[model samples]
Target: KGCTWRTVSVDKIVTRDCHSKVFGDIVQATQPPACLDACGSQKTNTSSSCWVDCFYKAAAGPDSGKPGGKVAGMSFAELTAAWEHPFLPEDQGGCPPVKPKPPWFAHTTSVEQKM
Candidate 1:
């Protein structure tokens, strides 16, 4: 009953500590509000993928080099782009913000102010 409602595989997303500062900040900012909910049975693990999906939107591109710098091996633009495919939304998709939000979700502006 937690964010790990879906257990995290460190190798997949990489440990949070391994993220570059700029990338880390982006991950924190765009995290889906659904992520804070208590764990339960669900058809999909949108709680976690929702966040990774959001990250992919911004990080999957030829120019994604900046964030991938410290995270990935060498410069492999097209290959990297192919690897981080964007998650398409289906049945409301993984893109929409959750209603009422999960507990303690921070307002974007508030988070920006703190940054």
Candidate 2:
């Protein structure tokens, strides 16, 4: 059971990473490449809502400067769905609720120590 749970967690991480990479690629192709780094730096700006928000604005915002309201062959709605899919509620056909760590859990550097 524990192994299965761990596998699900790993799968979620991999899926999130893949989605992020795809979003970043589309942002890079449509906007200035340096803008990607700018989004990273904007982490301090609470209003910006992190790199994802910045990238989303750049790729799909009204002033995005892309013709035909598309990025990398995906419509704005399609792109948003793809980028935000992993975070949607499970009943809405998204990932399950993340399991919280147990109170007794702790990392051990040596096998001699109890977990």
Candidate closest to the true structure, highest lDDT: 2
| Model 2 root-mean-square deviation | 12.2
lDDT of 2 by residue, 1-115 (tens): 5554333443343254444555465544565556546657674343465555556656566345446554334476767766666556656545554555554635535666636
TM-scores of the models, in the given order? 0.20, 0.31
RMSD in angstroms, all models?
18.9, 12.2
Candidate 1 clashes between residue pairs 3 or more apart in a chain or in different chains: 1-39, 2-39, 89-93, 90-93
Identify the leading candidate in terms of TM-score: 2
Candidate 1 is scored at a TM of 0.20
Q: What are the runs in model 1 whose C-alpha is more than 4 Å off?
A: 1-22, 26-47, 61-115
